[model samples]
Target: MADIFSPSRLGGTSQAVALASACLSILLVLYLMFFADLYRRPDATESQVAQTLEGRPPLDIHIEMMSLDPIRQTVEARLNFPERRADAAQAGGARVRLSDGGFVRELHLPADRAAGATSVEFGLDGSISAYPFDVYRTDALIAAFAGEGAQEAPLAVQLTVWERLPAWEARVVSRPARPGEVGLPISIEARRPPAHVVFALIVYAVMAVIAVCGLAIGVLAACGVRKIEAAFASSLAGMLFAAPMLRNAMPGAPPLGVAADAYVFLWVQVALMIGLVLFICAWARRGSPP
Candidate 1:
């Protein structure tokens, strides 16, 4: 029995199996780290011009919302106009029309002016759509003009929009009202990944460490480096408790049935289980004391 489990007897097979398993595990980790964006969520921003006359002064409108707060449902929005049209906007008066009828306070634009840009900043408060797993979208309108016929000639409009957070993927759709239509329609879609991708990498690292340890134990057992006792101890320590504990260390991790659990942890645990069984069988086959 001892001769059967000897290192010379086992030869290259054990080393090859261990090498293959380690390589596969490493590839899996790299794929998940670089390309997996598992927690990405969708959002959007858009702009358009509505109802313009051929001879009217060209008006440029810029709108941007940033630093959105999901808990407070608030955001900082900025609107900019061409210096050429600032006077018209001020005289005509500019206003933001929110979909939810929320209040927006217009801020003073600085005296320092860019070559052609005039800007007004505002704070927007209301329901911001932030669903679990991170998805967001909003619809609103801006109208500028002080008195009558503001909707007609010289009342040019332009809008620019964007997501508050950096996105893994994004889409923008703009719909300008037809020749005689009333308002401009725009839509924005953006997807953001989990807040910190590094965290996911950390979790994978932990799993890799335990998995490697388990694989090493299997190789050692096959090479007869030690009796079955060492194999059983290593497998139990590396898989039964350590792997799960490491997985749970991720902050605010999804439940046990998430993709990582199913794909990564499940495979590692199965391999460890098989290693454990192999060690037990080897011990039994040797007719060693229970």
Candidate 2:
């Protein structure tokens, strides 16, 4: 490793390091973002099939997010109703949660079947606050209806579920119009990640580039001077600029006094790792005698 760090080997080593760094960063980001089913159970049924309520339906139903922490016996959710009307008309109102018995049931159901049957309490029964599915229109009498007393708000009434531990993804399977077939139709789809994912990725990429460039430039500026201490200080300062990003990537680290988009935390790590490499290269350039 020392030999690889030598100026004589810097060119090849730098390229190799950069490439390895990029790949590792990408893999790390993907592992964090897509690999661990931390938020949802792996192989859990993601799609649901209901008897086709076909009519070019004005709205669509979807599960937004489901989190289960059994020790706490807690579940969190956000369901989606993709379309709503200018009027109070919307789609859906309830969902069923399935238990180990494979019986469909309401969320947070009571221990007594009769009580739960009457109240249907499995997790929060109604729509999640702060992310209501209703779309408020802003024209004429329609807009006026939204002035505080709209009762027919939009909601999602269906749910797709599977065992929490099974390695099987659930889909809403339905009986075919024919006499004996049952299967999920190709038209059914799981909920798509919101547009925010794309937006966050782009923003993070751009920020990473800027941070990397700043780190490289900081090192380069310090190299102009012959003082080793000054150059080291400059490099340290560069890394400090990236400290917030690093803290987020590290598990259990507190937020580093910076507000960041939670979704971009993965890419922020990639950028910081890349920036570290460029700084190392710049420091190598400075170490050479005039």
Candidate 3:
């Protein structure tokens, strides 16, 4: 067993193991980068106008909201008209109306426009309750007239709303119409990190630091750097105690034993415990405190 840690004996095997561990760590990080949409937030939707005039251009509308304020229950929104037209009136006008049990305040947008593709900016303030993971959704009645006939184009849209806090998981609900309808709704959702999600990410960051420390210790121990291994092992143990405190620091933290805790947090804790034990064993084998 001593030969495994000896610098002049079985050194090649130890080096190989260290190399393999490093490679595995790098591959894991790469996998996370490519496949993990961990912080993705869902927002935005789109739809096409069904009927068109004989010689009029097709009309497309894109709406987006951002800079959400949880306390005031408001969002900054933009309406974009991508298709340019020769007549400014051909682009038409829009109005935003809220559903029952909701209110809109401080809203401003141009009702008329000149020719060419254009965008209007506005703010929406609503009465929304964001507690116990409730979604505050309201509809904006958008009316526009297009072509020479001045047809009525109406859209019924819904968006998943959440508190503007960083890192929490918010639900996205979209209703797409079947064929033969005006057009299918195409949405582009904006991502916002909630508090819980941010906390989880922080915890994962600490776990990553622990993993780096573990890797360093493993490599050093393989090369018989006893003092360095002991130092890193002690640091690793100290970090283990600090990791759980992050949960307590989370703002508006969800109740314990949620899926994130059960799946991610618990697994991270278990891995840390195992790493601690291995460090202890390796330190003991070195026979004497550094």
Off by over 4 Å in 1: 1-22, 25-55, 72-75, 86-133, 148-154, 161-172, 175-181, 193-290
In terms of lDDT, the best-performing candidate is 1
Full-model lDDT for every candidate: 0.52, 0.37, 0.46
Every model's Cα RMSD, please? 9.3, 17.0, 10.7
- Tell me how candidate 1 scores on lDDT: 0.52
Q: Residue 277 lDDT in model 1? A: 63
Mind giving the per-residue lDDT tens digits that candidate 1 earns over 136-230?
A: 45444444333335353324455555434442333435555435434444544443455444566667667866666676666566667766664
**TM-score of model 3 (CA atoms):** 0.37
Model 1 clashing-pair count:
10
Q: Would you estimate the TM-scores of all the predictions?
A: 0.45, 0.28, 0.37
Model 1 CA lDDT for position 286 = 62
